[model samples]
Target: MPVQRRIFGRPIPAMSPRRMAVLLGTIAIFAVLTLVFTLPSSIPAGPSLGKFTDHKISLPKLKHIPSPSILNPFRQAAHAPPVQKNSTNGESSWYSNWNWLSPFSSSVTLDENRSLLPPLPDRPPIYTYYDHTIEKEQELKDAENAVLLTWRKAWWAQGFKPIILSPAEAMNNPLYTELQMKQLEAPMMTEMSKWLAWENMGTGMLCHYLTLPMGSNEDPLLTFLRHGEYPMLTRFDNLGSGLFAGSKADITAAVKKALANPELKAAKDFISAVPPETFEIDPKHDALAYYNDETVADKYPKIAGDIVGNGAKGLLVLNQLMISHLHGTWQNIFNRGIAVVKPHPDHMSYAVHPARRLAEFLAQCPESPMPSSCPPNRPKCKPCVASTPLKISTPPAYRNTSDLYTIGTVPHPYTMAVLTAFRDDISIPWIRRESPRDPWVTALTKELLGTGVSGAPRVIKFKEAVASQYGTAHSLWITAEGDMPDDLDWHFGFAIPRNATDNGRSETPVPGPERRPPVEHDFKDGPVPTEAELEKEKALLKRAKEFGEARTADEEKIRGAIEAWNLADTEAWKFARAFLARSSVERKKWEEEEKKYAGGAGAERGKSEGWGRWFDD
Candidate 1:
C-alpha cells in the first residue's frame, strides 16, 4: 500500500519508492526546459551577440544560474523575468555584463583618437554704412552698388564678414538720430553723424564702402586681433577716419573721447549759434570760413593740430570731391595717387608741393611758341564756292553761373584747398592752349579738320564732326534757324578715315591714274599759290577766327565755373596743404611702408574691378 498526504485532517496514503523517484525526475526535467527557453528572453533584444557567441558559455550552462521557480507549469511562461531595461539611470548594475549588447553602452570600447568635433572659429565683422537719402539718381545708386559689391566680395574672399548698414539701420540708435537731426542745420554734421553711427553699432571694423579697395592676402584684421594693443587701429597712424578696427570696448572708448572733445564742442557751438539765414545763402560758407579762420585755428590749436596731424582734413577733401560730380576732378585725384590707389614706390618723392611745382612751371613757360608758318598776304581771290548753300547757326549758350554752384560744394577747409590746387595747378594748365598743346586737343583737331570744304559747308561739317566725336549730339548740334541735319552721311564730300591695314597704310585707296603711278610732290617751299587757292585760304582763316572766338567764349565760361567751384573749396585746400606740410615725415614713413608691402602679402590680389575704375580712372 502507498501512503498519501492529505490536506487538513484527511488520511495520508503512501506510494512506492519507484513511483516517487519517477515523479521527482519529471519535475526536474520540466524546470530545466523552462530555464533553457526563458534564459535568452532575459538578455536584451536587437544587440550584437557575436562577441559573446565564440565564448565557451552555452544555454545549458546558463540554466545552472538561479531563477524564480515555476510554481505552476501553465503560468511559468507568464512569470518570466522582465527583459533587462536599458541603463537609463546612467549607472551599471550586476547585469552590466550584458551592456556589451548595446551600441550606446559605456562599457563598449571606442576609438580614443577620434576627434570630439571642434566648433568653427568666429569671423570678424566689417561694418560699412551707406546713406540712401542723398543717392537718389540711378547713376548714384549704380555707383554705390558697384562699390559695395567690391567691398563684399573682397571681405568675403579674405574670410571676413561684411555688414552693410543704411541710414535707416544707423538711425535706429539714438546717438545717430541726434547727430542726423543737426545735419540740416549744420551740413558738416552730415559727415560727423556717419562716424557716430559707426561707433553706435557694435565694433569690429569700419570703412566707407565706396572707398575701400580690394584687400591683399595678408589679413589686416587678423593681424590687429593678434598683436593690436591700442584701442583703435587706423589705416595710417592717426592719419584718416576712413579705416578702423578694434574690440568694441576700445572702439567705444576712443569714439567717446573724440565726441566729447572740448574744441570740437566749441566749434559746433560756434557754428550752431550763427543765424539760420547765413546757411541759406551758402549752406557751407559760414562753416567753411570758421574752420579755416586763422583766429579760430589759434583759439583751437589742439583741434587744428589734431585735424592736420591725423589727416582728417585731407580725407574730408577726398570724400567731398568724390561726391562733387566735377568733370575730371575725381579722375585727377585718383591719377595722382592721393588716396590708396596703389602703393607708392620707394623712390617716389613728396618733398615738392604739387601746387608749387606747377606754379614754377607756369612761371618758366608763360606761353607756347607760335608755329613758324603763317598765311601769306595775297590779293583776294574768288570766294570758296560751296556746291550747296549751308545755313549759319548759333550754338547753345553755356550753363549759368548759378547752375554751376548747384553741381557741388566743398565745406571742409582741406577739401577747398585740394580743389583749388586741382583747378589752378592741374585743370587750368591741362586745358589752356597758351600753357601747352594738349595731346587730346591736337588729336581731336587732326581728326576733324582738313576734310571739309570751305565756307558754310565747312562750318556745318565741323559741327557734325564735334557731335560725332562727343557722346551727346544735342549738346553739340548748332541751334540753327532750320533743323540740324540728323543724317550720318550729311558731311558733304567729307571722307571718314578708314582703318589702317597690316602695313600701316589706309585701307581706302586714292582714286588716281594708278597705271601711270602717282608722283609724290615735295611742296615744302614750292610754287606760289593760285588766286582761287588764296581765296580758299582767306575763307578758311575767317572761318577759323569765328571758331576760335566761339572756343574762347566757351573756355571763359568753363573757367568761371571752375573758379567758383575752386573758391568753394579754397579753405579746405589750404588746410590740406598745411596738413601735408606738417605731416611730411609721417607721410614719408607711410610711403616707405607702402613700398615695402606693395608686392608682398600686403599687396592687393587682383586688379580692382567694376566701378572701382570710377576712382582708378
Candidate 2:
C-alpha cells in the first residue's frame, strides 16, 4: 500500500515528484482546450498566431460560447459579423461595425467615398456707390479713392467681392434717372438713387455707404448672412441708411413702398413749409432747426412723431422719414423676424473728424501753383502791407513738380513744422500717409507758413498765404482769438479741451478728457480707436504743445491763448471721446459673448443668450 500523509485536516496518499508533475500537466492541457473552444473562432489571422502555428491554425467550431459571468453578466452570447477591409479606401470596416466604442458615432459618419459636410454657399456681392460728380474736385477724388480702395481691400480679404457702382452704372437703370430727377425736388433723393443702383446691379447684395468705414476684424456682413434671412437688413435699430443688405426684388419693393407711403408726402410737406430763405441758405442746418421747433412738431405731427420714434432728432425730416418708411416697409413685407440689428460699436462709423477732412485737402493739393488771383507783385510785396487778399478757389491750381525745395522761394520753418506734424499725425480710419517723405507735405507747409516776421504780422501774412495758396470750399483756418475776414473759410481752433495737459511734456500722456475717462461717456456712434490711433493722437498732442510754446514765445500778447482757443473745439472733442468710450464697451461685450459661444457654453444656454439674439429687436 502507498504511504498516507496528513495534509491540513485531510489524509492524502503521498506520491513521488514525477507522478505529481504528470497530474499537473494533464490539468493544464485540459484548461487550454477549454479556452480555445470558448473563444470566437472568427478572429482575424495575425503575426501572433503565425508565431504559434506557422501562419495556419484550425479550431473546431463551437455551437455556442458561454458569456462569462464576471466580465459581462448581463450580456447575451451572440455571433458578431466578420470585419471586412474597405477595398476603396484600404481601411478596416471595424469602426462602422463597432460604433458603440466611438464617442462621435452619433454626430459623424464615415464612408469610403466622400465627406458628409455640405459645401459652403457663395457669399453675396457687396455693393458700394461712388458718385463721380464729386470727382470734379481733385481733393474729393483723392479722398474718395482712399476710402474706396481701403473698403475694397478689406472686403476682398474677407472673401467678399465688392462692386463699386459708379454714376455711369447707376445711369444704366431707368429708375435711377427718375430718382435723380426727384433729387432736384428733394435733395435727400440722392441717397435713394444709390439704393436704386444697388438693386439694379445685383440679385442679392449688401449696400455699405462709403462714408462708414469698415473694421478690420469680424465680417459683420457675413455674420448677418449666417443668422438672418429677412428680406432686408439694416445696420441700426432705426433702419439707418449707412449699411444694409437685401435681395434686388425686396429692395425694389421696399423702395416703392416707401415712395408710395402717405408719410413721404407729409415729410415733403414739412420741408416745404419751412421758410424758403432759411431752408435754401443752409438746408441741413436749417431743416434740422425747423424740425426741432416745437410748433413745427404740432404742424407735422405724423412725420414729427415718426422722427421722434426714430430717436435721433439731428437728422433732416426727409431723411428721418425715409428711414421710418423703409423700416415700416420691411416689416410689412417680411412679417417674421426683425429687419434691423443694433449697430456694431466698432464699425460703420461716419468719418467726420476735421483731421480727416484736412488730410483730404492736403492729399489733393499738396503743391498748388500761386493762384492767378494773387497780385503779380505778391511774392515781392512787403510783409505788413494790406492789399486785396488773394481769392483761393476750389480745385487749386495744381503744378506737376516733384522738387520739394521749389514749392516756395523761401523756407518757412514754423509752417513746415506744422504741416509736417499734420501729415504725420493722421489717425483717421480709411486714411493713410502714402509716404513719410511726401514732397507735397513740405510744399504745403512752405505755402501755408510764409517767410516773415513773427507775431501779428506773421498771423496776417499766414492768413494771406493760406488764402492765396490753399483755398477750397472745405479749407479751414484754425486760429486763436481774432475776427476772421468774411471771405476766408476758417474754424475756431484745434478740438482740445482747456484743462487737458500738453501731452508732449509727459512721458505717459493721458488718452482721455481731464474731467472723466472716455469710457464713461454715452456715445451713440463712433469707432473704437486702435492702439495705433492712441499713439498717433499722443504724438499729435505733443506736436501741438511744441507749436503752442513756439507761438507763445513769438507772440507775447497771446500767451496762454492756445488753451483758450482749443476750448472752442471742446464740444466736438467731447463727442469724439464719448463715441470712443461707447464703442469700447460694445466691443468688449461683443468679444465676451464671442468667447462664451466658442467655448460651448452658448449651446448649454441656448441661442437666446447668444450674440445672435443681441441683434434681435
Among the numbered candidates, top lDDT falls to 2
- Mark the 10 consecutive residues where model 2 has the least summed lDDT: 487-496
> Which ten residues in a row are the worst by lDDT in model 1?
340-349
Candidate 2: residue 215 lDDT (0-100)? 21
In order, candidate lDDTs are 0.31, 0.33
RMSD in Å for candidate 2, one decimal?
A: 29.9
TM-score of each: 0.25, 0.28
Q: How many pairs of residues collide in model 2?
A: 0
List model 1 lDDT by residue over 253-362, tens digit each: 54455455444534443223333222112111110011222422453343444333334343233222222211121112122111100011111111111211211111
Question: Where in model 1 is the C-alpha error above 4 Å?
Answer: 1-119, 177-187, 210-216, 219-222, 225-235, 262-617
